[model samples]
Target: MRARNKPWADDYLKEHDEVVVQAPFDNKNKWQDFFGNDQPIHVEIGTGKGQFIVGMAEQFPEVNFIGIEVAKSIIVSAVQKSLDSGQKNIRLINVNAEDLRDLFGENEIDKIYLNFSDPWPKSRHEKRRLTYHTFLEQYQHVLKHDGEIVFKTDNRGLFEYSLVSFSKFGMELDEVLLDLHAYEDPKNVMTEYEEKFSAKGQSIHRCRAHFPHRN
Candidate 1:
């Protein structure tokens, strides 16, 4: 789906923005200072409309949350939702996921979440997939030693490709669930996409991947 351009999206973001961080970021490993605490930090890349991450922040007060998204209009919706939810443990960043290495230092993030990410299904566009080897290496640079990546998607092809990619990248697959809702965890928070897909009887695939410290 193409992103709809909202001329007033910036204004809406600014008005509702206690959470969105404007670019030119130099935080590099100083995220604890930004959140005014030394709590463990977790980031959700491509946090569409903010439902999952915001719900996470509310549920896990001891952990800090960051939502990274590139689209202005979509991110603005997330910001507004967070504001309405009155969640303080989360922040939003309007930058492409590829720039994460520059913004965060190694070991800065304790965990990362990828929820219903774009599959980039074409073979020619394989590198564009979030779980592609190149992108996994980027994720490694900022995640702490033993840090884990939790990924979920309704796309069967993407899930299978990711499982292979993670093994090839030497990341351990600690947990895998081909049918998430059927696994029945009450603590599970549904993203807008997850809810939508599940309602249509689409099975959600999820996994927890851990990257060992580089030698």
Candidate 2:
């Protein structure tokens, strides 16, 4: 069944100023203007309600975070949540992840987070997956050398596909955990989806992939 369109998206359209980019893919190199300094910038491609990005921004004040969500209504809630939490280092863009290269310059991003991305189940729809080679190529254009993509998902098939994709693209994988909760690390930040799924006794699959040097 097709997902119903979110109605609250219209309300967010009225408060456009709160959103940093009205059309991100069109202005690829303009991101530097939004952040005056060259401090490391991290991006979250699909920030479903903004919990993870906001929490990370608050936790790491020294870094800047940019979240891109195609759903305007959800992004509005994320922006409002960030504002209410008194966070100053985060921004949201309403756009498709495919257009990331058009919005960011070469080697401009320091890190990327792909938390609980949509699992396009059909084999024919595999290209639509965020971890697909096409999207990874786009990410490579914007990510700095050694920049890493931290991905977490509850879908094992998708995780396996992503691992192969990353390796085929010459990216290195590390910190691969089939069950995130088993890890004793405090740096783990759970997203809204992760929290809900983990509560239901689901194991979260996660991994970190980095671009190899082009020597």
Candidate 3:
């Protein structure tokens, strides 16, 4: 876990307390109560340093944002950002992505964001990658029938692999950008890792995969 060395981190730590959930592992229907709203909910699985989620929350007040991160120290900064920004629409949960089904009910989430997730380049670690078929299956369980997963990554290999995986799962892909920065589309929001990686001449890859319904 990296230390929150940024100036905003201290303020975040002072302002927000840890969120207390009754049973994040066994309960799958309590997520709706956490947001306290009927509006569409979007989740970011690895909210590193919280920049993207916080920015999105500020940008769209009507939509609710939930950030889940395995690192407590990182989540502390994320929660603090919500507090300092006075953003009631955003929430942070310190939990693993593998347990997402335990915290969210079936067809509960509207959208999912996988921003700069670990590529897990090794063949043996493919299952751990967020875009892997196994993890996508988990996401499918919690995501609404028409929900979509928006993914952005700098790793071309992972992006290509993910695209194949989504197709194999019978999902639809949209807004597929092989070179995101080169794309003129306007809905782009760069995460903390995106800014760092893209600045070094790395080509960012992006795609949106729609959940499939069984006939």
Candidate 4:
């Protein structure tokens, strides 16, 4: 289901530009300065509503969390949630994934998260998938050496396709979980989409992939 448009979304974002950036490119390499600390930075590409990012911030207060979402309405909600959570370590950007390289400098990010992303099942639309090779290349460029991508989804087809994409790109999987809910990991944070799917007996697939180390 698509998210309904919120009439107040724009005003909401303007009011909270501190949490959701109005011009993320301006902060490109100054992310640590934005957070007022030099802590490790973690990003979530498709941050639907900031649940996972806020939870992670609460758990790991030592890291800074940045969430990027394209939908204005959705990102507005995320900004509100982050503010309500009172986690000073959280920040959000309303921008598409394609703008990633333009927003962060090389080796700037320590880790990235992709939770319950769109599968984009059609073959012709494969390039639109977040795990596409081009997207992985951008990820590698921005991610620090040894940084990892943590992905989760209920779509089996996307999961399988992503696994192949990762391997083909010469990336290696550090961990793979066929049934994330069953794995019962204490550190795993569930997005709203994941909780809904898991309640319907869906098996959540998750993996940690990393680009090869520099020579």
Residue 167 accuracy (lDDT) in model 4:
99
Candidate 3, 113-191: lDDT as tens digits: 9998888999999888888878888899889888989999999999999999999988898779989889855757789
**Which wins on TM-score, candidate 1 or candidate 3?**
1
Model 4 root-mean-square deviation: 1.0
TM-score of 4: 0.97
Looking at candidate 2, the ten consecutive residues that score lowest on lDDT are: 13-22
Where does candidate 3 stray beyond 4 Å?
1-27
As a TM-score, model 2 comes out at 0.91
lDDT of 4 by residue, 100-136 (tens): 7899999999999989888999999998999999999
- Residue-wise C-alpha lDDT for candidate 1, range 152-206, written one tens digit per residue: 9999999999999999999999999999999998889999999999999999999
Give the RMSD in angstroms, all C-alphas superposed, for model 1.
1.2
Clash pairs, candidate 1, are none
Task: Score candidate 1 by TM-score against the native.
Answer: 0.96
- RMSD for each model, in Å, please? 1.2, 2.1, 3.3, 1.0
Please state the error at residue 109 of candidate 4 in Å. Answer: 0.2
| lDDT tens per residue, model 2, 10-111 | 666556555556666665765666666666999998887889999898889899889988876577778778878787688788776666777799988999
Reference-based TM-score of each model: 0.96, 0.91, 0.87, 0.97
Give me the runs in candidate 2 sitting further than 4 Å from their true place.
1-8, 11-19, 23-27
Off by over 4 Å in 4: none
Between candidates 2 and 4, which one is better according to TM-score?
4
lDDT of each: 0.89, 0.83, 0.79, 0.90
